[model samples]
Structures are given as C-alpha cells and as structure tokens.
Target: MSTLTHHKKSVRAMAQHPKDINSFASVSADNVKKFNLPNGEFLHNMMSQQKTIVNAMAVNRDGVMATGAAVFALSYDVTGTRLVTCGADKTIKMWKKDQNATPETHPLNFKPPKDIRRF
Candidate 1:
C-alpha cells in the first residue's frame, strides 16, 4: 500500500484518470492536482474556473474532466469532448478544449467568467 500527503488543505474530491490508470486527480480548496499512482509523484494542477471548494469530480474515457463545487453537479458528454456543469444558480455551463490554442496562447486567450454563483 502507498500513501499521498501532498495536499495542504482538506481534500474534497478525487477521480482517477479514465484512460491512465497510473494517474489520478485530487481536489483541495479550489485547485485540482494530479498525482501518479503507487509512486505518488506530484504531476501538476489542472486548469479550473472554480473559486471555492470542489465537491465532486469525474473523468471521461477520452480524458476529459468534470468538477463541481457548492451546489453544482458535473458530467461529460458521451464523446468526452464536452463537459457540462449545473449549479445552484439554475444555469448550465458547457466547456470544451480549444484545439487551436496552445499552452502559450491559453493563458492569454482564456477568459474566466465574470461571476461564479456559489451556495
């Protein structure tokens, strides 16, 4: 058996990578961090728009991830290309990866929502 102790805050959720058994994600505060299996090596943080504690998470077969917080629930489409999140605000948001955007462009091109309603 192995143990992972990297999270500085309380871990609220966890999800294994659907296609990669060697890795998994854990949510602490507003950040989702990735870690390797068995070895417990810290991988990296997944990009997110959440500003509060994450309550649930899931990974689809195509590696797409969905995370929910507050009164939200998240899920991915069958194709794994789209992620949908429904929240307490009675709104549903869809997210998809921009194929044309590179890592360098992502930071500049990505726009966060102006307001995130939390319960």
Candidate 2:
C-alpha cells in the first residue's frame, strides 16, 4: 500500500475522483489539496471560498467537486453539473462551474485572506 504525507494538518475528509481513477482530494483545515495516484505526487490546491475546517467532500462523474465545512451534507446532481451544500448556518449553497471564466479573469494567484485560519 502507498501512503501520502503532504497534509500539514489532520485530514478531515477525503474523496476519490469519480471520473479520474488516478486522482483524489483531501481536506486539511480549510484547504482541499489534490494528489496524483500511484506516485502520490501533490498536484495542487482546489479552489475554495470556505474559511473553516471542511468536514465533507464529494466528486461527481463529470469531475465536479464539492466541499463542506460546519456542513451537514454535500451532494452532486445526477447530471454531475451542479453541487449543493447545506451548512450549520442554516443555508444551502449551490455551485456550478463558470464555463466562461478564464485564467485571465479568475487568476489562481490571489492572496489568501489575512485573517484566514488554518489548523
């Protein structure tokens, strides 16, 4: 068996890619990190707007991912195009990938919040 040791804090949840057998994700504190299979190399961090420890995660057959923190549940629609999450704040949030978004418009290098908390 292979072991991955990249998470800096205790992992709270994990989910294998439903469409990519060689890919998976793990939640550590507020970050969701992706990793390659077999070799177990770190790929990158998944985009997240959450500020608390993620307690649940799921991936759909279309490669869409969902993460929830202080959340009771998260799920992907049957079409694999939409994700829904319900949190303790008594709110339900739905997410969809923006097909028109580009790296130029949604750059990945944005600085993290100065008050962001990490384990």
Candidate 3:
C-alpha cells in the first residue's frame, strides 16, 4: 500500500464549462478552499470567507466563472456588469453593480449580398 504524504494538497472536484479546460477556485495555506482545476491558481483571491468554501464551480457559456455556495451559485453576467450570488444566505444581491444605461455595441452593419463575386 502507498502512504499518503503529509504535505498532500486538499482538493475538491470542480465542474468546468462545456468547452473550458481551465478551472478557478479559492485556496490558501490553512483554510483555503474552492473547486478548481488541479493545474493552476486562478481564483486564489476569492478565498477567505471565515467559513466554508463553495461546493462546485463552473464557467458559463459566455466564459464567466462561478462558485457554488451554501444554497446557490455565484456567477457573473455575460457582460460582467453584475455579480450574482445565491445561497443559504437567503439574499439576492450584486457584488458589483453597473449603473451605465447602455452596453457597448458595434455600430457598423455588415450585410452580404445574395450574389457573391467569384475570383
């Protein structure tokens, strides 16, 4: 039988998006915890809740990362305008709310003709 090392890192299973390979989670030397990939430290900053870490994590179709909480998951909008987190906290609030009335958009329109010229 192989012996487990004392310095072995404590890792939890993390769910990644459909086409995402990189996962992110909060980790630390003591109470650090989160669901992330076994390769990198992407969510190292979101750690330290003075409690337990999220249960699961996943990246949205839009490429936004989210963390599972006691009851719900905390995720960002496609535009990154607001932070949405839901859980046993029984609260629905935004960590970062945007007051801008309009979002950025391309003004130019690209319409192709039915008939195309061949080289």
Query: Among these predicted structures, which one has the highest lDDT?
Result: 2
- After superposition of all CA atoms, the RMSD between model 1 and the true structure is 7.7
> All models: lDDT?
0.73, 0.76, 0.45
Ranking by lDDT: 2, 1, 3
Which portions of model 1 show Cα errors greater than 4 Å?
A: 48-50, 72-119
Report RMSD (Å) for each prediction in the order shown: 7.7, 6.7, 14.8
Candidate 2, which segments miss by more than 4 Å at Cα? 47-50, 81-119
Model 3 earns a TM-score of 0.33
Of 1 and 3, the candidate ahead on TM-score is: 1
Return whichever of 1 and 3 wins on lDDT. Answer: 1
Model 3 regions lying over 4 Å from their true place: 1-51, 56-71, 97-119
lDDT of 1 by residue, 10-74 (tens): 78778788878898888777567888887889877664346677877878886756666764567
- The numbered model that scores best in TM-score is 2
Q: Give one digit per residue, the lDDT tens place, for model 2 in 40-85.
A: 8888777544557778888788665666678867888888888888
TM-score of 1: 0.59
In model 3, pairs of residues that clash are 28-32, 72-87
Q: Candidate 3 lDDT (Cα, whole model)? A: 0.45
Question: What's the distance in Å from true for residue 101, model 3?
Answer: 20
lDDT of 3 by residue, 88-111 (tens): 778876766345534454344645
